[model samples]
Target: MPVSPAYRPDPRFFDLGPDYADAVKAAEFPKHILRHRNDRAAAEVGLETLSDAEWIAHLGRFEPLPGQPGPIAMRYHGHQFRTYNPDLGDGRGFLAAQMRQVDASVDRPQATSARGASDRLRLMDLGTKGSGTTPWSRMGDGRLTLKGGVREVLAAAMLEAQGVPTSRALSLVETGEALERGDEPSPTRSAVLVRLSHSHVRFGTFQRAAYHQRADQIETLVEHVRALYHPQVQPGDAPGLLAAIVEASARLTARWIAAGFVHGVLNTDNLNVTGESFDYGPWRFLPHYEPGFTAAYFDQFGLYAFARQPEAVFWNLTQLAGCLKLVADAGPLTDALNGFGPAYIRHLRTAFLDRLGVKSLGEAADQRLVDTTLALLRDKGEAVRWEPLFFDWFGGFSSSARALSGPRGKVWQGEAFDAFRFALFEHEPECPERLENPVFARPDPEEMLIDEVEAIWAAIDADDDWSIFKSKLARIEAARTGYGLG
Candidate 1:
């Protein structure tokens, strides 16, 4: 295989030794059927040139990448729904390989230089889902349903398109096997998914060290995170590191709100130190601005619901702060925690305005626009959809004529949106040319609701048809281009 010059293998996690992860072997499947491949993402890491057979050999068969270690199952303990579980770890997946790649800010904010240095090379991980069983599998089978893989791929694509920092779905291969799962119909097809992410070090990683009372290991882990992800902070400044994590988490949560995304499971293990949203399960995009909407059926109490996400994130940060307490003092850590609320409010205003495609008119005016928009959505209830609202009213008053003439125009004309309309007129559109994209001419914006997701899966499950799935992704790509959020 001809590896491109961009591929720079960096097996730094392997250097962390056995305390952080364990070398493991991948399971042999009956067959490997390539289902999806993210060439755009693959090109970023120089894996786009691989032949289909070669792609399967490495990602599906789990063959080690050049100059990289074999599959290593990461070890960590996390709190599930506020309940700590020591047995939690990489039960079905492992870190397959690591490499350095140029920053690919696809529909995301531009990367900034850390410590005033042009550090464009980002450390990325080629991690797997449903690859095989590991020491953390307990007694259950380490497998993933084909439907689950499809859902995650869709979730990642939509989230990325909406400018949310998330893991990119690199490859998804269907393994010829039937597995029984209680969550879905029994005897479902199985698959393996590979995700590309900046970092795989989760908050649970620190918690595991703290749980074992290893202050030395906690210190080592902090240094590792600082050197790799937060180089802007000074060495040995644990409090600064925590504060950076808090800021990132706050920004991510704010982005989620702007995108109308509900990350059904907000467990500590699911949140990494980089604050990029990954390991998506039962994720959903809101149809309206309902605060009580939840994606996971198991979340009976709405712990990780649409509105409580910020609270869930803060609680998780507290747990992470607890772990850091093993190495740092309490005063600075508390101060770091104190930053979450204000950071979230600021990021939320910015994210909300960005979605509306409007320029901010200072903090007070921006807050009013955000508040009025939410109030209008809540007042209208389920009468209005989420994405279309942003799509129709994009560019503030510049889009007034188009929005009033478009679908749901009557809803916008109603007295309920009067305050929002007045507030929107105060700001001008940031990029009026983006509205010229053909995707804006469509009757309704591209949405990934549950019924549509089920329909897409039904086509695949019943007749092995992937046309709808492929078409949906293409449409989403067009929307990404139209939004031009990056």
Candidate 2:
């Protein structure tokens, strides 16, 4: 196993003082059943070398990695359902560790030699949900139901497969315990989940400082973020950090919309500073391109509905901008916040094309294509669903006419699809050979609908059956490959 020097860990969150975090220990469980492990992500942090037992000990047992001392529950406050709540923090989760991931995604600059890999690295945080309790437990058990853990596992995988910038479920271990919950059956299963994300610091992290009138801490946070996440942001460049975060947030919002995912909760605390989507509680993929689609059963006002996602994201960005007011002037922060509209539109158009597996003809033609496609989906309404339409015409104008003539082709009629076809024909295909896979040869693409997800859970609940869940993951992987997104 090869390790990169990027594995160097710098424990910075503890610098915020004990007010920000409480050192915590993992709960002892009767059993540690390894359910899912993302080797791909493990490889990024130089941990793919660990054996299964060692992996469980490190992730599940909370054994501190090299340079990591212990876990700390971060402090923050956020507006839950638009009401500011100071009681909120990592009630059931904590930052387990932080490491630099060797990122091979960047292009080499002329200043570097071409023989070696690009030394650029991305900072990653190991966030464990339902691991144990800390100062912010709030009188609730700090354990996750096994079914809830499974649901989150599926949610992260599906989102990643659809090209969304999302946190990955690194490891899941069943802590042989019976958990009683009102949402599901009583005495339901229990487990621990570990999520690997770019950063655990949320917009609300700064909110807490602002709430306590701690401008100095806010400025310190700004400097910390600038040094770690955005080196391009020079010293005392508050506006530059805001712009970088805004751009990332804009892209994230657009990607979620393009993927047809409704993150039921868009609260500031759940919104990461790095702009990667994590902390999935109540999330859903739209059955169709319905704007009124709501994911949370308790979200009565549709605040975080499918169509209102971009709005909610921008609103969170505003709250983040408000925190930046402590260090930066209001003028430049407002200017950066105001850029979200145009940035969202631009990113949405590009993301829409990318999701459909098509290359852009140019800005004008691509925007036209995006507009027509969305217009068609809106007009079709209940007559068409989201996943199948893309599955039916993945290659756009050059999609298999024969494949369309099958069950998926039944709805390929009408003026809505006609407009889409004409607009799509203007652009070249991104990966035409993607349709050649046997997965695409089938009638339906891999979809993560509510019923399908429930059915998967039912299997787990009955006789410890995991075949359905495993096969579903396999199918989703095949779909990801079929879309040429792997």
Candidate 3:
């Protein structure tokens, strides 16, 4: 069945043709065991009515839905871990299809300032991972461990609850196989993943064109981006478009920092052009506000460390700017690249305040509040954890008492909260009622520490028990609702 009237078929990426992608077949699994599905994300693209079995049929087995055909493996090159790699693309996955979604612009008016907003451009990409091998699969078998899928589901759900712009795990299916991995135990369970996001186009897509000296292809790709994603992009204004993307990346980066998220691999291919975070591999949520925290174990040099995320993002943006050099003026593109730092700093302060459900008291006051809040957390040190600090001080310092009653109250009510409390008095909360939730009054807010994630996984690995996983997801969902973030 067609998803909805809003599901307009736009096979735009194919216009770039053979050089850009290769047709591929999805691997058929012996069993299509459904692991997770996001009905909320489904309704955004008008596919909410899908049954569990139907989801597996489409996403699991790669059955083409109305207005879409077989999946195509997109081709591009990227800088993985800061080194140029020309062989990368959808090595284990492909863009299955694209569809337009219903608009909620009225619910997000600030979006208009960027491009006046458009219902037509509200798009979603159906992409898969570990479903099969493709032209881009270099030497490795295209398979995903079930544990990997589980981790992804948890990561996306948690990030969404914290209001990070991230891809949702629309469907995850156990594929009834065993896979070997260096990181996890050998012969782990296998699964296939379906992800829903704004777009899969990455900075490396342009890098490939520029590398091959295809100025014409670069222009074509830029125009496609303008028409499909950023309609407000003025003609011949490639630099302007890059500037807009920088602003978006900065906004999301700010949110990531605010949420204490560290995307272990910030490779060029992993950073989508639309600024939506996807391909959750080795992501981690910090236990405390430690800048030097590194998520990926092999990050020996710690290039994409927690605190240097802003720097890494700027570096990737410069690479995108470098690609634009073929079709746009170098000076303007450089200027756009230079603006990232300020944009990140500005949005970070505002995002920090907004996350607390507090109203902005202009730039100066907001900066002071954000700076003071983070400083207080650092000052509090090892005694407090990340989530609890935000929990106690949510809606600013007014919720302190409610925050303290929780399991960690004694530690949360430390002396550092004194300056933090005064910091809250200067501004009104955007939503005071959020503090009324029972979550605030509890002795402990739900925490997703590494130990907790491992415990949940251990239960599954031991007895195939999903009770703990389900309960944890439910608790995270409750936190999402209680905080009024969703």
Candidate 4:
């Protein structure tokens, strides 16, 4: 038998280099490398052969880079639920390392890993819990709790399985350190998270640079984003680069909506310039379609509510556009703004239709059914109830199919729906077999918010009884894979 090529990590991402110590005062996690291993898939990668120490050393290696900010800090400002906040940067997290052009087979995007590359943007950051302050720590301890780490892992994994583009957890290790906090009982424990994704640059990053009037840095950061995520831009097409960013953002927000996910916070700092979803906390997945369902306890105004997400994204983009105006003209930028609505609508429609296994709305009636269902979901506050509808109908041939087509068809025949339905299915193929009755077998309302999920995790941590947690994960994973989200 022929010998295989020596196993290696993606060459592209082989240490893109980090701008370490550029802004060192902002660094809290003293350069300490923690040893870790791939308990999951080291075998497949042929990395199982590495001794434990070898793996740990590889995981712990941190190379500093030229021109990299000491804190990996970029400049930008952002709105917190529509309020202008001129002060914000990596308040707690710091860019620990950067792997350039890492080939992540998982996302199929050759970009720096968010957490670190195991086919994801693998990034390592020390989530400070009272790590004693930084430029962005505001008035509180920057410490994050162990419970918070657990919650973030669940949120990121759950959302990712649900077809939501989100941060992936590579590691979550408790730091044996104490810190004070008002949010939690004092002497908080900390954790480190290694995220996998394309990039971690945020709307806040751009906002910070813009706020400081560092137009040169803004331009540099824009180029960095483009080079990493949207390298298709021709030599002189800066406007195209901006538009590409806008388009990516639009598609991302649309996916969040289709998956029934509410980010809870769309703060400029939380909005990823790479158009990736970041900073998961107080996030909620709708059990029922409630327009006012708020995820964050702090979001008392529901600014990042389920229904307002798209609007929030558009608004964020407008803020980003303002920053871009420092360098670009107004006219083409206006064109980019106009693209958000239609592009988002198109993305949502395609993704939603795909989940239903509806090849095309072949008739106005078919369109009306979906439209009516969505309306009812929104009005009655029951979006999660529709999940089974997708499973039943799209699974093909069930009692629910008859309910969808026979008596229930009258909904589409109604005045408002009649014309819309006709136009919808006119050009599409019909899948009568795919229709299913919207029967809800369970009486209890479904919920998947951070707090609700934390309850399940509590059991896992306390008793290590993971039966319930495993079942929930299975159901959500089934939903994702069934709909091809996985």
The prediction achieving the highest lDDT against the true structure is 1
Provide TM-scores for the models.
Answer: 0.96, 0.94, 0.94, 0.73
Error of 1 at 248 (Å): 0.4
Q: What is candidate 1's lDDT per residue for 336-435, written digit by digit as tens?
A: 9999999999999999898899999999999999999998888888999888888889888888888889878888856659989988889989989988
Error of 3 at 6 (Å): 4.6
Give lDDT tens digits, candidate 2, residues 1-486. Answer: 233333446466756678677888888778899988888778777677678888888888888876776999999999888889999888888899876665555432322121224324677789998888778889889999988899898999898888889999898898889998887788998889999899888999999999998988888888878877877889878888888898889999999988889999999999987889998888999988788899999999999999999999989989989988988899999999989899988999888888777888888888887888788788778777787777777777677584478685667767877878888887787878776789867877788999999999998898788899889888888877777767
**TM-score of the candidate numbered 3?**
0.94
lDDT per model vs. reference: 0.90, 0.83, 0.82, 0.55
Per-residue alpha-carbon lDDT of candidate 3 for residues 156-254, written as tens digits (9 for 90 to 100)? 899888888999889889999878888789888899999998888899998889999999888988887877778788866899889888988998899
Which candidate has the highest TM-score of all? 1
Higher-ranked by TM-score: 2 or 4: 2
Q: Which stretches of candidate 2 lie over 4 Å from their true place?
A: 1-8, 103-119, 400-403
Q: How close is candidate 4 to the true structure, as a TM-score?
A: 0.73
Candidate 3 least-lDDT 10 residues: 108-117
**For candidate 2, what is the lDDT?**
0.83
User: Which candidate do you rate higher for lDDT, 3 or 4?
Assistant: 3
Worst 10 residues of 1 by lDDT: 108-117
Q: Which regions of candidate 4 deviate over 4 angstroms?
A: 1-75, 100-135, 138-140, 178-180, 184-189, 361-370, 379-386, 395-452, 460-479
